[model samples]
Target chain A: MSFTMTKHGNVVVVDVDGQLIVGNRQELKQKVLDELEKGERKFLIDFARTGYIDSSGLGVLVSLSKKIREQAGELRLADLNDDLKTLFELTKLDTLFQIADNRDRGLESF
Target chain B: MAPVRERWPSAAGSTGDPAGPDAVRLALQLEVPTDVRLIGRIVQLVSRQARELEFPAAICSLNVPVALSEALSNAMLRGNKEDPAKRVRIRVMVDPAGLVMEITDEGRGFDLETCTQDPTTPANVVREDGRGLFLMRRLTDRVERYTEAHGLARNVVRLTIKRPPPADGS
Candidate 1:
């Protein structure tokens, strides 16, 4: 997986591409946490290039969300395609985080 | 010499029969672009075929297939090891009285229980990994991992979704 980080004031937009699975979970989680530690509470993970996600991917998201929320912040997922959207719904995670259809709409919320 | 069979149930009312001796018809490989719709399509196929052999929705086989698909994704594409073109072999069959769903991969086999994915805990839900196996256990009646007799270390996973008793009052 490839990760690209871009900062928008307090919002850190992390763009993930390719398959997000077990092998890359540690590096991905650490990157998110490192940013979270710097008080960048709001996160917008754009899945524009992400093809697939598995258990490890989902777990890291959940853990990171908690980490951010604990610091009085929020985490949002943007541009998740229908496939990933169904996964979120099936797992009932669509109810927990703030999911938006596009990046502009997602970042604009905060 | 009879082929090894593994069986289990699902959580949804997925009516799939795994008896009567009919074998599963699964494509021998992973055809890229693993999306939710494709996953649902495969789940539907498994659910339909399993129900045909009498393993009806008494165990929610629908969710079980999802879990299997998750495992497939992990074993197939997660290692930057997408070279040589891997194929995920899925077979569904019954032995004596057990319903089995088997997925054989062309990659190196790994441990299942040691995985650290937690879908129930929302805090860890968005990490991009770890939820597949987590959900697999939650939605299926039972899940087990073992090495195939051929020494291929194939991940022999199964879901024994039971069916409701006949309504004839017999």
Candidate 2:
């Protein structure tokens, strides 16, 4: 998977493209952690183009969310399609993360 | 030794299609390393075949792939411990009845009954691990775990998903 990071005001939007499976989940996790380490918080992950995600990918997201929350930083998700929304709901992660319908909404939440 | 085809009578009975006209059976075997990329590739290949057989996108693209990914990861990562010297064997069968995928790893077997945890609990919700087996059970129609006594004991995870009828009513 590939990620493009762009600044939308104070919130950093990371657009993840392709499937987020075990093979490439660490890349996303590392990037998020690096941003966190650099003191850049208020993150929004854009999943509009992502087609699929396994439990491994969810684990990465969970870790990222926890790390950011622990540091008093905010993390939000945007543009999750039906399949992804269902996945999060099934795993009960929807209750743990702040999800928005679009990028603007995700940015506005922070 | 001849290839053994141990039909899952339980799965057949569940689908209520012991032998139907639309039941076409095909089996594929692959020996892959403990690489996640290779596992994804294998799942993609089988998913394409599932699509060609008129499986719905929800099943072929989403449900099957998710279940297969979790099962394969467990076999390759946890079971084989990412040992390149060890190989993971994947056996896939698609028939009118449904789809059956068996992933065998060259690791000591574990009890399937003990592989579950409550992911919805408050304490486990934020954890980054321990959700693979849960996802596998949720996404597939049936999941069976056992050990095969070959030269060395192999951990086998069998997943079965029934094919949905065509949307166009064909």
TM-score of each: 0.53, 0.90
Q: What TM-score would you give candidate 1 relative to the actual structure?
A: 0.53
* Model 2 per-residue lDDT tens digits across residues B73-139: 9998989998888899988888776788899998876788887897979999988988888888888
TM-score of chain A of each: 0.95, 0.97
Query: Model-by-model lDDT, in order?
Result: 0.62, 0.86
Q: What is the per-residue lDDT of model 2 for residues A1-110, given as tens digits with 9 covering 90 to 100?
A: 69889988888899989889999898999998998899898899999999789989999999898899899998899999988988999889999999999998888888
TM-score of chain A of 1: 0.95
For model 2, what is the error of residue B69's alpha carbon versus the real structure, in angstroms, after optimal superposition? Answer: 0.5
Tell me model 2's lDDT, rounded to 2 decimals. 0.86
Candidate 2 residue runs with Cα over 4 Å from true position: B1-17, B20-22, B165-170
Which lDDT value does model 2 have at B130? 82
* Candidate 1 lDDT by residue in tens digits, B1-170: 99775433332223554444464332222243323224445545665655565564533243444565665555456521454355555665433243456655555566777775555565654444446666667655566666666855555555443334567954
